[model samples]
Target: MPAFLESERLVLRPVTASDLDDLVALDADPEVMRYLNGGRPTTRESVRRRVLPRLLHEYPCLGTPGFWAAEPRGGGTFLGWFELRPLDDDSPAEVELGYRLNRASWNRGYATEGARALLRKAFTELGVERVTANTMAVNARSRRVLEKAGLLFVRSFTEEWPDRIDGSEHGDVEYALSRGEWLRRHGG
Candidate 1:
């Protein structure tokens, strides 16, 4: 089945080769890439050769487990993408949830909405045991999104990044929600 998920105002479709341009453009925005790559723009060649190929490879064996391009539901304007991938050495049924939205789309609640929808799908349909997301400690906006989606702060760990941005020393925060926790929160 073609990987497509929908929210009230957004459409989520698997990232394909045709989405290279949109992906590149999204990653090129300095503010968008700030916490990720030290505000450095990604080269189109890298996006095409490496990023696009990786996304395409995930289409088959990954089992609807890759990044999905996010667009406006009615107009199909590219907003950004959401990633739901199984961790290395993990079963397909267990996945990590993530989102990256364009700066223009920030503060509009798209990220939180999309993430909540995915979490719902995972728990209700995919038999997911847990869903987790990570972000820089200083990224209060992202941390808030995860919290709004019902994930609780689990840990803070440091990893070597390519370029330390303005707030790397504080470490990265991990947020997670287990199937039981999700069910409890919903009074199931």
Candidate 2:
């Protein structure tokens, strides 16, 4: 089993066909999808026909890695998923960082640990110039994780969602780190 990247606590690997059940369960959790889809459960048909295909196919396209299945390096428990993929594949330097974790895996610094590892890979190995992440403005927990992972508060903005989540009125916040900024804090 090949891993795309490894942190001290996590082994980040691409989602395979074998990951459907895990992905479905993760998305079905209300807390996990609170900010994403307002806790609306994704139908099994949707997961099978839509979500899994995109996740499965992206590994070949993202090259270095796309979305990853984040599992503990210790006992190999499935924690959740993390992503560091280009917004536009034609320009691979501007990547985005995002994560979704199991409720059981919450508050354990797993998110921060995984995020920092991806940032290190982005700046040092992948030559990414900038990485950005966004979350609902009221998602203080995720905001904190992004900051802890070295992404600074960039701005707050709004997106017109077709079906807005509960906290959308507060808008969304973006956090970011540049290669130079990352090196300044963590050393090159």
Candidate 3:
């Protein structure tokens, strides 16, 4: 499949039905799902019914799927996925940035690389006015990746989570960058 985006060591392509196994494996890892679902393994049925459909749907505002399967540059294992989805179905002004990689791919800079690339695309090619991301406050590693991708801390807020997980008491932190800010920073 042709890549939707590329970085030095990774390629992001539109997610497909063939990626079901990879998604299942990525979501099954306890370490990977620690913050997401308190280490609860997502059943393959859930991946098929809920996750894959969301991943496959092309946002009307963006004219493309918001999620992409991540893989190594020259064809390798599925690393995980990256997302740059519009906040609203009809607007591309604001979008959320996200990534999930298998345990084997963590701490290897793939997340940061993919994130930076997405931010660039959001600001330059996609007509996005703002890019935002958030994670549990306890996820220092994820916060660091957002910072390294050039987003600044916005605010910390708490919401009702159906199933509370570790660090839920600490709330969540939002990070964001505007297109104007990005242009100024990149001299675009």
Candidate 4:
């Protein structure tokens, strides 16, 4: 499939059924799942039944799948996935941005690159007014990526987690960027 977006080092394409194995393997790394589920590996059955379907669903607002598999520009490997999904299925005015990468892809700037590219698309082409993201307050790495992608820290709040993870006690932090704010920052 053609790319949904691209950055200097990554290509974002709509996720497909063929990506199941890669998704399973990405979720298998305990370190990768630490903040998400306290190092619990997501079972293939779970990925197949629940995760893949969510990733594959096309959002009417965007007229495309909300999740995109991340790979190298030349199509090397599945580094992970990125999401720019509408907060409401029928509206593109506000969206949630997120990413998950294999441990090998971490600390290499792929996350920031892909995120900035998505932000650009959201504001300039997708008619998105605001983009928001949340991560565990203790996830410094993810927080840094959000900042680098131009999202400002909005607040810290707690929510019920079905199964609490290691840093759940610290709550979660929300970061966001309004289209107006983005344009000011980018001199648009």
RMSD of each: 1.9, 1.5, 0.7, 0.7
- Model 4 TM: 0.98
Candidate 3: the clashing residue pairs are none
What TM-score does each of the candidates earn? 0.92, 0.94, 0.98, 0.98
- Candidate 4: global Cα-lDDT? 0.95
- Which regions of candidate 2 are displaced past 4 Å? 59-62
**Which regions of candidate 4 are displaced past 4 Å?**
none
| Backbone collisions counted per model | 0, 0, 0, 0
Residue lDDT tens for model 2, 1-188: 68888888889988888888888898899989999989988887899999887676553334655688989886667788998988876666788999999999999999999999999988998868999999999999999999999999999999999997998999999999999999988756
Clashes of 4: 0
Prediction 1 global C-alpha lDDT: 0.83
* Each model's lDDT: 0.83, 0.87, 0.94, 0.95
Q: Per-residue CA lDDT of candidate 1, range 125-186, in tens? A: 76778888999999999999999988999999999977779999999999999989888877
lDDT of 1 at 178: 91
